[model samples]
Target chain A: MATASKAAADSRANLPFVYRQYSAEQLREVLHKMYLIRRFEEGAEESYMRGLIHGTMHLSIGQEASAMGICMPLAEDDQITSTHRGHGHCIAKGAEVKRMFAEFFGKTTGYCKGRGGSMHIADVAKGNLGANGIVGGGIPIAVGAALSSKMMKTGKVVVSFFGDGANNEGAFHEALNMAAVWKLPVIFVCENNGYGMSTSTARSTAVKNIADRAAAYSMPGVIVNGNIFSEVAEASHKAVERARNGEGPTLIESKTYRHRGHSKSDRNRYRTKEEIEDWMSNRDPITLFESELREFGFIDDRGIEAIREAVAKEIADGIEFAKASPSPDVSETGNYVYTEQA
Target chain B: MDAMVRELSYAQAIQEAMAIAMDMDERVFLMGEDIGVYGGAFQVTGDLVDRYGADRVLDTPISELGGAGVAVGAAVTGMRPIFEFQFSDFATLAMEQIVNQAAKMRFMLGGEVSVPVVMRFPAGSGTGAAAQHSQSLEAWLGHVPGLKVIQPATPYDAKGMLLAAVADPDPVMIFEHKLLYKAKGPVPEGYYTVPIGKADIRREGRDLTIVATSIMVQKALDAAATLEAEGIDVEVVDLRTIRPMDKQTVIDSVKKTSRLMCVYEAVKTLGIGAEVSAMIAESEAFDYLDAPIVRLGGAETPIPYNPELEKATVPQVPDIIAAARDLVKGVR
Candidate 1:
């Protein structure tokens, strides 16, 4: 019995951080969520093509693992401030895809009750402050939320997710400096998807890696292959633990790529088709994570097929729920501008 | 409403209100550039750091946009942050967070969040601090829908309105004039609130109604005293809150007074006076106007560094008296 226990402990030590930390059931659930994020975006894309949704959307087709891995270590009460390309983050943070679809459909049952359609969608109850439309806008807000946590002794660590583009913004520098100076519990996650709109980070940013800028703010600068679930989750786990321990913030630059353009309006003039196809076929986060799950015996072929089928059903049901939901009254346009007086 | 009143300067009144608010709620705190041991640019947050400690009385770095956004974020979560822009002109640097985020967060989030933040701005000219340091930009923020903008004139209103702003669930902008810091008035001790969006009739008369705001309220009252000997019978209406402006009070005063003259220290064109003039024109008071409406406001120029030039920029007591005399005596 002593020999068997020793062997089990050695086996766990050889496994990845996520495998060591989470149960097999939780790992399977993570895969299910990754599939949910991918399918949800694809569903939203199809809906947009059918002219059901207005306005452009920023899709995160190839960054599923990054979103799931970052959120895996966070509790339901642990807050996150996302960017415009934030559907994956919202889903990974436990937002129901049905309500997200309802918001896109401009229905009252939506998370924002049709007020914040896509860019501003939030699940406050789930601790998603909201996805900001402004680049680097949520950075300071995350610091402020961290300040609230430290001041109120709530022990809630906040994660601010931005793109490579936000690295050049003054708000990014200011927020990082303030967070570091105050030793606030927050994580600055920059998903370096190569570009901010059409501009590449090499052309826009002064630093080679966004994480390098974190040094000026006096915090740990971590770089990870965002396409690899284990790599991203391992980095996130350490950063989150450091934050909870009140050691201050860490900057994690999750190096990844977007399978799609910056937005629906993106003409795809900047990058080559060969590069896009390469990432799609070789470096797709969902494919990589799924293969890892299978190799580790966490999910088999049958299990993967069932998860895909379930996700497909959830997407279909979500679209139907959105279609059947009611739109807000035009007369109530002035509502929510100020708190309703009791 | 209580008889426990004492003479206090506008700055002291504001300081006392901050202490009272901190005592009442643990979430209430102050954030600014020099609000700690430096005591603030205008010495408004004097030594509160000693009592509340640096944790609550935070001295933020000179990052206006980021600091303002932080306050908004804290407010939305649970903390009641009172962010002070060292100078009102610095508000230009932080307009994105104040206008786009704090003012629109609640509406954009579909009421899922309310930014209960209070931002204090020491506004108006006369400090000889040049164009950048001195500006009456209350009208700029007052234009926003979700924000409640107030300009308290006296010590009593400063303390009361500040406490009211702290209690308000929405974002409240207090535009305290720089010149009024030394101005003294009777202030009641302890916690009290002066309801926002309500105007105070400083002095009542029958001939001409002077609608004033901030420092202009006191100037108008002084002009009323001077005109009393001249038999002008001027009524001074301190239009305290700018956004959900006390339109009823202005219209009623106009209906009784038969003449209206808007007095504000902001630029004469498109300032608070324009809104007051337009409101009266659209109201029932339009028929009661015995003479053309006059606007006594700041000159159409940036506040210069010279003391005399700065005085010339905004309306003075003599300017109010002249404007009032002309309106009451049937002269444009």
Candidate 2:
């Protein structure tokens, strides 16, 4: 009996942080969310190719694990500010895919009522303050939200997600410094995908790692393998705890890669095709997370297939919902410019 | 707006309004550089830190862009933040957050959010601060649709309009002239609000309409008094709000007087005067013009460091009087 108890303790210690903490059902949901983010981007790309959606979209096809992991430790009321490449963030923050697709379709039934397209998608009810189009624009805004949380005694934490390129922006430094000085409950997550548009981090960034800059603000700089869901989730858990305990902000650098170009207009000239193929084949986040789930016995082949089938159905339904939604009237273009006076 | 009134400087009235706003709502707070123990660059927020403490009256680092963006973020997330730019010209540094984020947030979010933030600017040239420190850039922000820009000419309007801005559901920008901070006028005590988007007729006449904004209003009033002696009968209209301007008041005054003269402190070309001139020309008041419209505005040059040069750069009482005399006498 003593040996069996010791063996159980060893097994629990060997499991990933989330696997040890969460139930099997909860772990399966995490896998489901990861798959949902992947298929959602795939569906969006297909729709974009079919001429169903106008304007451009920043797809996060290869960065699903980063979004899911960082958001795993957050409560429903915890707030987050996203970036232009923010579809995964929006989904992870609990935005309905139907509304997201409808927004891309510019329908009145969309999340922003068709006013904001891909870049500005938001679900404020879920505490996802809209994704900003400007690089590093959401950094200070997240600090402000954290300031509100601190001042109002709301006990809520805020996360600011930006690219590695944003580390060079003045807003990032100013915001991080202020957050540290005020001891505000906020987390700064830099999803360093190695490039900002066509410029690589080595070409644009000054530091070896984006996390290294957090030392300037006197906050803990954490780096994690963003493709590995367990590793990213573990780092996010510690950061979230630090924020909630009134210890001030933490900076987490999730080193991930994006399969697609920066936008629809990227010509694929800057990086080699072989490098993209390597990340796609060896480090795909959804594939890694699924294997982990299967290894832990949290999900079987049937369960994985079932999750994929469900996600496919949801994506198809979301597209149908967006296609059927009505466009806003052109005459009402002036609406929402100001709060309509009573 | 109340029976009990006392004389207060424009700066003091603004301070009292901020205190009253803080007292009324716990969510209201002030943010700026040196607004705390240092009492601000112009002493406009003097000694409030002693009363409300540092948290409520935050003294941010000299980070205009980041500070403004934080205020926008705080405002959107259910806090009423009143941000003060030490100098109006510094707004150039923070225009991205002001114009892109604060002004466009509500519209871009499909009316899901309202940024109830207030920004104060100490504007205009005088006191020999040179070109960088002294500039009337209200027109730059006034050009945005989602922003409400106001230039209160008196202590009463300064206090009342600030309270109104705090209570407003949208972002409101207040441009206070540094020279006007020491200027005193009657101010009522307690809670009161001067309605925004309305013009005040400072003086009435029948010969010509002198439409003015900010410190230019007082200059126009002084000029009107001088023109009265010369049988000009000049009417002075204080254009309190720049964006969503009170066009009907200016139009009626021009139609009644049959002549128009615009006076402003910004550069003469493409300033408030141009907008007022174009507005009248496009309105029913166009046919009422007995003479060519005149714009008494700043000279087409940067505000220089020399006292005399600074005096010449912006419109003065003498300049307004001369412009009004020409317009009333039908001399282009």
Candidate 3:
């Protein structure tokens, strides 16, 4: 018993978070994608403030590392179901900035033709099952996708992304349990962003980490620092590999903080500005990865500036393109009610 | 071309439809609790596991929410998943997936994709499974816009409609009454499809029109038989698909008969009958009506365990006869 326990502890202590060195171009592309999501969300907030974009927006400003890292290893056919704060997931999964901005701007050019706005944006053609409005709503749907993969022998994997608040939903438990039972190829990525709108994980979640609950479903559960791209990448790569190998699902608790409030309407009364500042100044994923790449001799200070300039121009251009896009005709309102009624 | 015809029960017919569909399409699979070895809670999926193996005929965990969620997930990923709810009453556990996810995914996603999922619910009150196990929730499912809600009244429809639902691109909810499963009818041997949203004239007459669904159709047919002896002709239109409503058939029948009666096993208030009533009331049939539209549905109460009380809630043959007499006699 002592030897067995010691082996488990040693393996747990030696988690493989070593950064996989990539080409200068590959690193630049990844950093560039992260920059795109950050600026796109900031633009959405700016548009909301200016009364150009209506309805609510859930920003994934601080959680970009987890999104890019987790989706990096996924195939184009691999599926993902993200939460309300799913702009990062959608962008990381390769959604165009123009279409995303167009969605926020309520244009027909948007992924959902201005009907879904931000919370419901999706690109099913790109294998993004959707961004759900309801918390934990996508878990079961992702599980269903995984079930299809297993039944059809499609050799595809599904990643179900939800917040810490969503971890408390019955869907989370039900989906996880079934996925485990059937050995469905699913990776449940819990973005533990501390707060579910206003309620803190400490106030609501019973476990120390969301991954601890995975044991109930008889699957491997691991915690990774979501702020560090390497950790998320390594953890997700292993999980995704497990899924592809037909070993079944894994529960990954990506412990990260949302740099912005839960949604656009929050006033920051839930926590101190000091806590938010601590995360931003100390653990911002974009800056941390930039510094890491610099240390690795991947790029210099000049390269960083060029990347930033490129992304800023892309964001401005995308926003302008979205502004030029038209709203859907009222005639299209009733077309999708059913699939042509058979 | 003459096809082989065999008299099969509703359960056998449904099983045959799934078997033929699975054979024709490798993408089709069945998922539900106890459907594999146990053959399903109501034995509607008997011996399918033996023929299709455990992979195609899956026995899910006893979590309806989880089972339904996985089925929804599978359906969207290019598989024709026929998910069975043990009873219509237990569908409350799967409302999130059925209503929010399945019915709204295509519309919410701007029609980029469609969920070709088929969910079968053994519904209506006849078995002493009481309130939790016997409820006609088709009206509830029919209210959702992006769903094709079907109620196969006869063995012929039970077979044909199930095949058609598998072919539909949108989510289709098939409500099979527990009592209808054992009722036998002539089903064709090979693959065929009954057109969805099209009503079938079970028995045609001229004096009055009876629009009935599921188990209520049989009762209405018996009532039409009794009304024949009373010197009043009746037209029986079996509404196999409820969501599409077959409004044109009912309207045309009412126009011909000049009287309308809508019957279902759900609660009388805001039921499918109400929709049938309003359809005629708002259409050209309204001008041809000799009397007000009569809707005979179950009483607005939970189905009791006692066999007599259970039978009392919904319209029996005698109750249908009495209601038909009142409507034809011009009694308000």
Q: Residue by residue across A235-332, what tens digits does model 3's lDDT show?
A: 89899999999999999999999999878779989999899999999999999988887876667989989989999998999999999999988887
- Kept native contacts, fraction for each prediction: 0.76, 0.68, 0.76
| Higher-scoring candidate on TM-score, 1 or 3 | 1
Each candidate structure's TM-score, on Cα atoms with residue i matched to residue i, is 0.98, 0.98, 0.96
Worst 10 residues of 2 chain A by lDDT: A1-10
Q: Candidate 3: deviation at residue B213, Å?
A: 0.6
Whole-model Cα lDDT per candidate?
A: 0.92, 0.91, 0.89
Q: For candidate 3, give the docking quality class from DockQ.
A: medium
The DockQ assigned to candidate 2 is: 0.82
Tens-digit lDDT track of model 3 for B62-157: 777777878777888888999999888889988988888899988888887789999999998888989888899998999999999999999999
lDDT of 1 by residue, A206-291 (tens): 88988999889999999999999889998999999999999999999999999999999899999999999999999999888888
Relative to the true structure, candidate 1 reaches a TM of 0.98
Can you rank all candidates by lDDT, best first?
1, 2, 3
TM-score of 3: 0.96
DockQ per model, Cα? 0.85, 0.82, 0.74
Off by over 4 Å in 3: A1-18
Question: For residue B41, what is the lDDT in candidate 1?
Answer: 95
